[model samples]
Target: MPNVVLLLAALAFAGCDVFESSEPVAFTRIALPARPVLVNGTTVVRGDYQLSAFTRSVNDSLISVPTIDFDRQTVLGVFYGGSFHAGCRGNVETIEGIRLAGDALIVEVGPLPDLGPCRAIVYPSDMVVVNARATSVRFVGAVPQ
Candidate 1:
């Protein structure tokens, strides 16, 4: 009898929306060419991806390119163009979560990680594939200004 009561209580809480978690958006890490000179900012690729800030030919091949179905998907790119000195080595931007807040879609990114001092040039970048189209997409948390 006690076991049945406990199971019912657990199921009730699990069905509650207050305890629901946001669905994570799918993403992939793209490798940029050696010493890639890219503009520092967020870039959204919609329709045709022919943006000058994102197009480059490395070894006669395109780098950081992803196949997309523009009819139902969108690509969001986060790039840290400026090189960071020692102290902040291995700094990179990571997409943490993507969820709907009110009527807008919010993309969350992890903050810069604190690491030991090391002499290395770090250029953090990420490519995220959003599954749904939104009237407005807003990026929040840890995005390079």
Candidate 2:
């Protein structure tokens, strides 16, 4: 009887949410966007902002979600439950938005955001911000597993 009780207890512990992953399994096989792959300095305007693809990096199997704040002059390459803050190397005057646009990374720029120091990260992923004078920046970079 004690043996059966022990097995039940073990099963209960294994069934806890803590033992499960928070992110979806699809993230492991997610592919990088392709628009940034065709970056040629062409400007794509939306609303009142102008967008451009200046740099990109792609991951093999690892998933890296891109996050940027022109207001804070910061970009986060998030993956494996950790946000690797790095991207943009120039003066970020303003930012309208940063998100994935159908496998493509799109950034919308406004007049200008506050000026601040640029942070760059190279490990596990690569990110960068180019042309402080430009209004927008796009990335097709990937974060491998």
Highest lDDT among the candidates is held by which one?
1
Clashing pairs counted in every model: 0, 18
- Pick by TM-score: which candidate is best? 1
lDDT to native, each model: 0.62, 0.32
lDDT comparing candidate 2 with the true structure: 0.32
* TM-score for predicted model 2 compared with the true structure: 0.19
Off by over 4 Å in 1: 1-24, 51-53, 57-61, 83-93, 101-103, 114-118
What's the distance in Å from true for residue 7, model 1? 38
lDDT of 2 by residue, 1-145 (tens): 9999999999998888555432111111112232222211223323212212222232222323233334433232222113342443222223333554333345433432222344653122223332122244353333222
Candidate 1: count the clashes.
Answer: 0
**RMSD score of candidate 2 (Å):** 17.2
Per-candidate TM-score against the hidden true structure: 0.62, 0.19
